[model samples]
Target: MSLANKPNRKLIATLAALLFAGSAAAFNLDSNVPITVNADNARLDDGKGIATYTGDVVMTQGETELTADRVVLYRDETGLQRIEASGQPAHYRQAATEGQGKTDAKALNITYSAPESLLTFEKEAVIEQNGNLFRGDIIHYDSVQRVVTAEGAANDNNGSGRVEMVIQPRSRQNTQDPDGSSQGQ
Candidate 1:
């Protein structure tokens, strides 16, 4: 859980062999950094500690970046409390360690709560990491606890939305033996 520690190489190499239940948040190292947002237009209510941004909003927090049509920031005396972003399909991306590829996410709406360290994506949410993809009607990610939950949307009809995932096969690599002898050697 500590970002300072290096990711398990064996785990990364064998990720494809692992059957993901589609209930884990993307691994990001910059979750504790400060967030910065930008937009063409903004309306700030200092008294309420609320700010609204429209027209191609973009937000960044360390290596993580988010883009949307509109974004609203809620803050208190202690600083940022929550962020709400909405668009036809908002975008989210973050770096994935040193050698791993980046993680990407898309959704119609994304809400982040600073107090709870939770991120909720609604309406056709999808996340792709390390060539694998996870899809669902709703995805809730708890950054602090590193827990994730994917939920299906419910309509008047039965089984409107279902969670889906696509896991790619791991590429073969030269691995060393337990005795530290190089396989190629």
Candidate 2:
């Protein structure tokens, strides 16, 4: 399907739905889950448990994966706190827990809070789920509350400066039951 990069009323509504629905509890990440990170260069400060990795960094935990040019892992005396990643456009993806789909996203800067399960994307952010695409200057997602917020950048540019989105019609296969269960088809 073609994507509508133009901004419109439907774009706003669809972006709202994507930002929220995309965070649905389909892939609830457990805090106790171990996270592994690989990078071309890494440095750790044992006193603070803060590690910085640079140059083609890849972090993974279970079905979730994040890749970036640089990634900084923050941890306190209690435990891991947050993960900050930056790149030309950092990438993130997670397998669907309850279905056969995935969530994919990219941004210049991406921050993930382990405790809150929140993800914040800054600068040319885009998220896609099932064929829908949402684009904006910033996209904030609260996994716990299942809330998403997207907004355009506030520059003195001479334009509408509105968020853009594209929503595809649901496929027939996605609407059908896998067990070939049909009541009155």
Candidate 3:
């Protein structure tokens, strides 16, 4: 939809929820914030309950944001069903709950299915949160169950064919000793 004039609030709200819900520590109020989308071009087919935005597309709700070269949104009678975004590397970011900092992700393609509460990243997928990192050819996050699965490239001789993760150690300053003083202190 040319949302330049009449924006679809329902669609936007549904999208905001689906996008941010994947983050386990997403800011609680993000879903209640108004969403804004900007793109060079947009096409909406109400009959199919589909909308497509091309060029540099940026969507934001509160501290959560997504940017890509193209984005497609699909909805059914119930609500938004799925979202697909593609770019050289589509990017997503959202504030984490309280002091956890932010979660950031990037991939060549990203897809989210509302009913399944699943978020998938494909092609050079990478996600970083709280200084921890996960990288693979594909990654899936189950928001409801708070589980993550990743797959590396196939046994192609040219590729490493292994998923990679870097889990940073918790800072000593945040850990308390048995005596109730900070570990570092």
Candidate 3 Cα lDDT to native? 0.72
RMSD of each: 9.8, 7.2, 13.2
Candidate with the larger lDDT of 1 and 3:
3
Residue pairs that clash (backbone atoms under 3 angstroms), model 2: none
In model 2, what is the error at residue 24, expressed in angstroms? Answer: 6.5
* lDDT string, candidate 2, 1-185, tens digits: 33553554455555555434534432234556677889999999989888999999999877788899999988897677788999999998876433535678999999988777889988889887666677788988777665667888876584346677776555522552433222233
- For candidate 1, the per-residue lDDT at 95 reads 62
Please list the residue runs of candidate 2 whose C-alpha ends up more than 4 Å from where it truly belongs after superposition: 1-32, 155-160, 171-185
Q: What is the model-wide C-alpha lDDT for candidate 2?
A: 0.73
Question: What does the lDDT read for residue 7 in candidate 2?
Answer: 50
lDDT tens digits, residue span 96-153, model 1? 4433455678899998887787888898898776557667789876655555567777
Cα lDDT for residue 37, model 2? 88
Candidate 1, superposed: residue stretches over 4 Å from native: 1-34, 155-160, 172-185
Query: How well does candidate 2 match the true structure, expressed as C-alpha RMSD?
Result: 7.2
Give the TM-score (vs. native) of candidate 3.
0.75
TM-score of each: 0.71, 0.76, 0.75
